[model samples]
Target: MLAKARQSLRAACDQLNIHPDVYEELKWPRETLAATLLIRMDDGSRRAFKAWRCRYNDRRGPTKGGIRFHPNVSLDEIETLAFWMTFKCAVANLPFGGGKGGVCVNTKELSQTELERLSRAYIEAFAPFVGPDRDILAPDMYTNGIVIAWMADEYSSITGQASPSALTGKPLAFGGTVGRVDATARGGYHALRHLEKSLEIDPDNSKVAIQGFGNVGYHCAKLLHADGYTIVGISDSSGGIYDEKGFDPLAVMQHKHETGSVQGAKGHGKTRNITNAELLELDCDVLVPAALERQITLENCDRIKARVILELANGPVAPTADRKLTEEGHIIIPDILANSGGVTVSHLEWVQNRSGYYWDASEVADHLKKTMERETQAIWALHNEMSLSMREAAYIHGLRRIAESVEARGTQAYFDGA
Candidate 1:
């Protein structure tokens, strides 16, 4: 994953004719920390789990990313995620670099007490490296606001300091931004809104399909549906349900909440159960892969027929598929830009924590809309002016900022002096 991420960045740099030396400093992470987390099991036995934190860069600002608790977590994956976070933050114009941390454990198997202990232990182990001005951790896969709150509390108690800014995505009572929960989806909506004029598709007339039913996917479906888009299909990990005429996203969400899946929800349109692969190929105006990385690969790029492919999931469209889709004239909204709302809101949360001021939901939403629109226009303008792919244009736009910062700081002089 790290190799692929570096390849994508390098490809973009090459298209821009960026000097290889400029990229030499950007290719590898500044630091990668691995630790063993010792937690007492519910059965009174202790187990050690491997955990990792990767700080990709700090040229722009403090590192910002999430801590994911999953069985498949590894140092390489965390580093790749941190690298993506750097670009994502840069694309969003946030004052943050990239960092990510994760523990290789399935939280579902642990009891509530055990989960808390594990969360604290993970923070305790990494406390020396993370802080408000260092690396700030948020919530990611299998981790939520509760986990973030726990981690933040642990950090504060351990350090005996008031450091709410050390983490984002905590519960609102603990300083989380009001719009953080749906920030990722909301950001995607803003990107799609900005692209509507270029795509020449009316929201009311467009049929939308989302290939994941998690927080990001469901919230995206809701926001788009409220905006008058016809949600034609929705899916989860198990499978997806499709309706040709369009489905009520709110109803589907309620059903999914009750039934734990959207597979068997009764609807007016054709209720056919389809695999995620089949759902991706459905004839829709916009297809959103909000699930996981590599969902859209070279093998399945030919099957996609959507006019606009909005990636709400991180790395949902693989590099190989990205090339194919670009060749096929698909307006692929890259994840760095499409799914940056969460981090944008995280910035808001951090600001609020630092300033002791908070905004209402409408205020937050309006602020988010303006930021997303401005950034989208910037990226779109760059793409048109340079005749480059959106992904390449975004990378060029973001990398230039980071590269300029690195140069302005005389970073190379320090090494030369050494």
Candidate 2:
């Protein structure tokens, strides 16, 4: 996955005629640390879990990304996510680079106490590698506010200083900024809203199908539905639910909360259960893959019917599949540009943390709206001007920023008397 992502970067570099030093610096992770976190289980036994952290690049500033806990978490995945984060921050013009961390474990299998021990142990292992001005960690898959609180508290304990800035996505009382809970979804929302007219999408008539029912996906559906879009399909890890006449996001969410899945949720019209794969092929105006990576790959890419794809998850659309979809006239709102709201708000949290001043909810929303619209518009302009796919254009936009920063310190041409 990292190699594939690098190919895209290489292509962008070639298109931009960027300094070779820029590609050299961005091709590989600057540093990656791996550790075995051993913890005591509830059954009086010890178990070991593999963990990794990759600071992909810090050319812009300190690295920032999330720590995910999942059975499928791998070093390659972390590095790739970090690489994406590097571009994501640059795309949003955040004063940070890219970094990511993960543990190979299923949170559902662990007791709360065991989870706490594992979280602290992770902090203990990577204490030397992370800081406010270094690599900041946020919550990702299978991790949430309580988990972030544990990690943040452990970092404080290890450093003997309250360093809330070391982590984002914390509880409000713990110095987390407002508007961050839905920032990722809201960022995509802002981008889509900005492009509605350009994409010829009418919220009153268009249908939306979301592949993930998590925080980001739910908020995305809720926001779009509120704006008069008909949500035709919704899915979670368990399964999916579809309706032709659309469903109310709040009603589906209430059902999901009560039943632990969206499979049986009721909609405005006929609601039926479907597989996650089927949700991707549903005829809709917008398809939002908010769940996992590589969901719309070569096999399923051909069957995708949505005219536009809003990627709220990192690497949800594979590179080859992205090309096919774009060639097929699908307007893909690339993940770097679409789902950068989380990191943008995280940057704001970092700023608020450093200044010891917190913005109100409205202020945070306003900032996010402005940043999302500005970046989205810039990327859209590049897409049209360069006749490139939105993904390619976004990469060029971010790559320009990163390459400029890299060349500012002087490239080989400067050293060679160009």
Candidate 3:
């Protein structure tokens, strides 16, 4: 993942003809901290979980990113994610750098008490390294609003102050942004809506297949399905359900919630269960790979039949496959631009937390929609202006922002006076 990240950065820098120093500056992380947290289990045993946090860059502002709790968490993955977040925030024109954190543990394997203890323990270990003005953490992957509340409470207790700005994705009762829960999917909805005409999408006839029925995936699918698109296929970690006549995303979500997976979502229609890989290869108008990274690589790139790819998952399309898909005229709304609604609202939550003021859900949704639409249009315009791939265009746009910031602060070469 880190290698692919560097490759994209290199391409963007080369395309922009940026200063060598700028590329050199971005080649490494600003800071990386790793630690092990030991907590006693209900079985009267102690288990140690490895955790990591990486600040990719702070040229723009304080770092902001998500803290995921997945079994595959690692320092390299966190660093790559942080680097992507830096670009993601810049692409959305947010005042934040990139930071990410994670602990290598499966949340499903833990009881409620065990999970709470682990989440708080993670905050305790990294409390000294994170803050609103330094690095703010949000939910990602297996992490959610409840988990974020725990972390925020831990940070507050540790500092002896109520600082909800130090964390995001909190429950609404604990100072979270009003519209943050569905921000990611809502943003993608606006982006795709902004591109529907250009992408030649027929809302009445468009067949959508979403891989991953998690938070981001479910919300995105739900929104798109409500917007008249045919949600023909959808999946979770276990598997997926597909129907030629299209399935209601909400019903599928309800089934998943009740049955622990979306594998057997019946009563609405006759749907066949499919694997994640099969879902990826399913012929559809728009394919949303919102599950994990490197999902649409070269091996499966040739099998993709979607006219458009909206990456609700970070780094879902490998760099090589991205080139191929673009060459084949498949419009890909990159993750930096597609899934940035979460961080954009995270910034808003930080602002509200700092001001000790809150806005209604409608206000948050309006702001998010405006930002996502504007940024999506901007990327489309850049794509046409430069005759570049969407991913390349996004990278160049963000790289320019970072390059300008880096030069402005480091050399003061472009400024007239100090």
C-alpha local distance difference test of each model: 0.89, 0.96, 0.90
In candidate 3, stretches whose alpha carbon ends up further than 4 angstroms from where it belongs are 267-269, 412-418
Output the number of the TM-score-best candidate.
Answer: 2
Worst 10 residues of 3 by lDDT: 409-418
lDDT of 1 by residue, 1-418 (tens): 9998998788777876665656887899999999999998989899999999989999889999999998988788899999999999998889999999999998879999999999999999999999999999999988998888899999999899989999999998888889899999999999999888887989889999999988999899989989889888889988999988778877888998898889998667568888888999999999999987888888888989998999898888888888888988998888889988899999989999999999899988998898888888999999899888888888887888777777675555566887
TM-scores for all candidates: the values are 0.96, 0.99, 0.97
Deviation in Å, model 3, residue 239 alpha carbon: 0.6
Clashing pairs in 2: none
Sort by lDDT, best first: 2, 3, 1
- Model 2, 11-89: lDDT tens per residue? 9999999989999999999999999999999999999999999999999999999999999999999999999999999
Q: What are the per-residue Cα lDDT tens digits for candidate 3 across 1-418?
A: 7977899999898888887878888988999999999989999999999999998899999999999999998888999999999999999988899999999999899998999999999999999889998999999988888899889999999999999899988998999879998898888888999998888888988999999998889899888888888888888889988887888777888888899999988634677999999999998999998989999999999999998999999899988899999999999999999999988888889999999999888889889989998988888999999999988888998888898888876653444454
Total clashes, candidate 1?
0
